[model samples]
Target: MTKIFMAMIALLYAIPAYAMDGTAFLKQVDRNLNPESYESYRKLINVEPDGRKKEYTLFTVKKGVDKVASIFLAPASEKGRSTLRLGDNMWFYIPNVGKPIRITSLQSVVGGVFNNADILQLDYAAEYTVEKVEQNGNEYLLYLKAKTKTVAYDRLKLYADGKRKLPAKIECLTEASMLIKTIYFKEVKDFGGGVVRPAVIETDSPLYKGYKSVMIFAKVKARDFRDEAFTLTFMPNLESLR
Candidate 1:
């Protein structure tokens, strides 16, 4: 009983009263995020400075480490399109082209604007090291440094809702010490058991001033996915995965 009490005390100290310890916050975030049995309806709206707007709806599913799939539907514009990221490989399906293109590690990302590595959602524990913690009013901040050059962002600053333990904002710094992008979590909802997923994610880039991409999740479903669903053989049938 004494040891348990000590552990509890250590945990309390590790988690700040107004903010979570940098490393400890990440540990909790990792624990609370379940890659398996996760699926969501994502609507991505991109607004350009030229006033041109494009929207796409994606059905996303994740089974485990390096296993993911996205099916494009809607707007009557993006039909029969899909993308699959399995392990380290990313495959792109274009109905107009009638074939799938595989992206290599050396090549750039295909979908949206973020780098492929960034979208792949690499394990946070492997990619970043927590540096410090801070508080801004009611928000708790976590400063992180990239562990390797493979990570697109050299520095990461995360702001979390103090009471909710959910991310409120993220600042990603480029290697040049310039702000690359910032993501704001507008709404967070508990889904599938006790996991908290963002209902909307708004992303803005320094390169594209006055431009932003808003992603809203319309529906979320949790299910068991097979390893084969993320393979090249199944890339053509991405729409059927759902």
Candidate 2:
């Protein structure tokens, strides 16, 4: 049909070519996925091989590409716990502990496949550089390399929806390209105010063979915050922002 042919033609052109700038396209995808500054509520669930599950809800805020903070909202034990990230430096605060302690990118606040880097994630363009882009049917596959050794995943393979420019799946890898985990993004929903993207991100890792983690996003909104809100000194007051 003529309509189908036209749609195919449009997709072909939309797909990144050798002449297209990979970094620019990646940045576009990052923006399409989230605003430069925003607030969101996420329910993180961890599942075990025995079918046991644990869930925690968080109120997250981001000020820029480098600053992000989150506070746990549910489960009495983690309710007052907060985490902050200013670039590569991260800290976790517990109400009783009173002082913020440094944490690593690979450590998990909510144990499962997702680590600190994934929980307090910055913009993809902030941490990664596109090494190459390829078109796979209706999707665009992006090969990403971490700009620094401190990055959690040294390599990433991202498959994005060509039409929406949003990631459909991501494979996290080590320096040698060994697969660490696979994250699948699904259930796209519109959160309004120009925020529309996947609401569910489920992840599994071979390293944690019997474990899985999922992030369910809700009420995501585009908004700006103060840089101080992303500091260790502000971790205890993170809940006040919401």
Candidate 3:
């Protein structure tokens, strides 16, 4: 009887260790994607059901956990437009408006599968808590829950590569578990300074049936910036940072 009780106690102690391992791996995945503060360039392409496509280029900068900013760099119309995210607060700045306008995580700035929250995303570990983790064959499936209601997606199903510890796909869902969109990470590349991650991210949604969006990342290198660089006043001056 004492041996059986000891085995049961050992099993109980093992449970929490398993849970912590999942969360710890999640943090590692986040760091593998990008440095805490860095800059990069991305080309966003939106495709219609008819194959018509529109593209926009952006220079993005991210600072510690809750600060990120992005500015349009190509296409004359989108040039000079910028977006900033400071914690739960987000804002869009237009050249003509000359003032920052508040925005929500659910709203799309460029109109596609990716929303404002996705474009200016912070570390996943920052906005989400791992609810559970499962190992499926060669992949790790992470069940994530939003830390707060203000988050864009209520829950996320993240499937990561077991060998690389990088995300392979993510499914965004509503509170009632309705499917919103699925994001696929692809084309891994090394951008120097230990920054090796997916260079292409494609997303599609049942809600936006027949439409798709793709983001191609480039020049994703580690670099530091001042706090002012992620503020509204610096939105117009974002280009200068690059």
Candidate 4:
């Protein structure tokens, strides 16, 4: 009888230790990945099924959860091109055209598996509400649903490191739970000034078959920027921020 009573007490105490608030836990994982506002340099590589590869470098900045801007830094053909995203609205600007144009979230800026939404991703906490959380061995699997219809992906399955609380993999999905793409976070590095997270994000999509895309991150440090810096008018002047 005493052993039964002790076992019941132990079970009662164990529940709260792993009994996590899904929403709060997801927010922690998001912050562990990146600051709310910051700047980063990324090299995007797109590999064709035939083994040919094309790469583009970009300098990117984000303010809050909704505002992000990026400018191509290499490949003369893609250089000077910029993209500005504010909430659900996104625009692409070409230097020769000298104007900003609307773009859909699923459209790729550099023509790869990654789309504009993937490139200019907002905080997972801001866009998704945790629908379920499960412990899968050493990782925590978080099932998320978009907070609004305008969110880029209707559903997301995120697998995060249980100890680090950083994402290990994320699966973007449609409303019907159809898989679109899988993003793998790898090569954790300390980027100085308290930023420590994945240095590489590789993605593959069923739609693209054997093609894959990778984004290598560097110099991801925290910084403050003006709201005007994320506007269409600021697209031409993005280089000035660097």
Candidate 5:
């Protein structure tokens, strides 16, 4: 009995206490990806099974935890179109529409596997609560649950690199545990000014077989913005900030 008790205690001590705090580690991963407030330029590419592709370039600005806005920069048809997210509310502005329309996180503005939620993504820690964490070889797998029903995905399985503390891959699932999509992060790069993270993020969904979407980060740097920059009226002039 004494030996069995000692063995159990040894096993418990084998895992570090800090590693057990999944929430703290999740926040670390979020900060490692980007600062709390920053601006970035990205190119989103959607490829069809027939070897055809469509691309859109965007300039995205985010402030704090609840405000994020993005404006399309390329493709004449999509130019001047903007999207804003203020907490749970989201709006889409089109040049010809003349007014912003309410949109949902599940809708895709660019028409691909990547949805609005992915394009104007907030900090992961903002929407998810870490349910548990496990160490697998040199990687850490984090299980996350959505904080509200409005979130795009109800659950997520995130695998992060142990050394770099960056997400390697993520599995987005429904509340019923149905697999929706898998996202892979690759091509780590240094964007200067203490910003270093994956330059490429690729995602594919079982619901849309043979279709893949890739987002490539061209530039990401820390920059502050005014509260007005994330409002509906200011969305039309988002290009001015660039």
Candidate 6:
């Protein structure tokens, strides 16, 4: 009779630990998404079908808790080209144009493929709230809701690797529950220092067929960028980036 009572006490104590599963999982995923510690990486991007490849040395720096700035230097083809993001705004520098073009945060990032928000290094926590944990085989899925009017998609469903807890796939849904984009993460690797980074990301839009963008991170290394590198006034310095 005493053993049975002890076993009942143990089971009652385990309830609190089991209840922490959702919050614990959310915090773990958030830690991986925080870009503050993952300052930079050497990137290689390959656009599909065309078999085109480009290389860039990249840098990421956090301005505050909800703000991050990333810089790209593609010396091979896009030499002297610079892209900057401050909060929700993005700007580009073209050597031929001799000026920086201000790209609004909502301009739908036009380039190889994918929407502007997908490329913009914005604060994910501000825009989305995650919940409704579901497990299917080896994957865990969560429903993310846009918290503000400024967001592009109304909802996003994310599928994460069950064992690794890294993002595996993301599905975007419109305000009316229409599907818009589906992004898949492949070849994810740890970028050292406990950052689980996605090496290859392939984004596909439902509006376009036979069109997709595959970003491959060939090398990832920690880096430091001066404050001047992330400023709008310093956008035209191609020679200084090298």
lDDT of each: 0.70, 0.91, 0.91, 0.91, 0.92, 0.62
Per-residue lDDT of candidate 4, residues 1-242 (tens digit):
99999999777544432477889989898788889899999999999999999999999999998899999999999999999999999999999999999999988999999899989888999899998887755678888999999888999999899899999999999999899999999999999998889999999999999999999999999999999999988899999999
User: Model 2, range 1-242, lDDT digits (tens) per residue?
Assistant: 99999999888765666765779878988888789999999999999999999999999998778998999999998999999998999999999999999999999998888999999999899999999888766678899999999999999999999889899999999999999999999999999999999999999999999899999999899998877778777888988999
Task: At residue 2, give the lDDT of candidate 6.
Answer: 100
TM-score of each: 0.77, 0.92, 0.92, 0.91, 0.92, 0.72
As for lDDT, the candidate ahead, 5 or 6, is: 5
Count clashes in each candidate, considering only residues at least 3 apart in sequence or on different chains: 0, 0, 0, 0, 0, 0
Off by over 4 Å in 1: 1-21, 30-35, 50-52, 104-123, 135-138
**Candidate 5: clashing pairs of residues:** none
Ranked candidates (TM-score, high to low): 5, 2, 3, 4, 1, 6
Lowest lDDT sum, 10 consecutive residues, model 1, at: 105-114
- The residue ranges of model 5 lying beyond 4 angstroms of the native Cα positions read 1-19
lDDT of 6 by residue, 1-242 (tens): 99999999776543333333544565566566544433554453435556665445544454433444445665556656566676556777777777778876545433555555666545555567765666655567777788776676778888887677777888888878788878888876777766666878787777655567766654344444566666778776534543
- Residues 1-242 of candidate 3: C-alpha lDDT, one tens digit per residue: 99999999777544433534777888998998899999999999999999999999999999999999999988899899999999999999999999999999999989988999999989999999998887755678888999999999999999999788899999999999999999999999999999999999999999999999999999998999988888888888988998
Model 2, runs deviating above 4 Å: 1-16
Highest lDDT scorer: 5
RMSD of each: 7.6, 4.9, 5.0, 4.3, 3.6, 7.1
Candidate 6 segments exceeding 4 Å error: 1-27, 33-35, 42-65, 75-77, 106-110, 221-229, 237-242
Q: Candidate 1 or 6, higher TM-score? A: 1
**How high is the lDDT of residue 164 in model 2?**
91
Error of 3 at 75 (Å): 0.9
Please list all clashing residue pairs in model 2, or write none if there are none.
none
Model 1 Cα RMSD, 1 decimal: 7.6
The runs of at least 3 residues in candidate 4 whose Cα sits more than 4 Å from the true structure, single-residue gaps closed, are: 1-18
lDDT of candidate model 4 versus the reference: 0.91
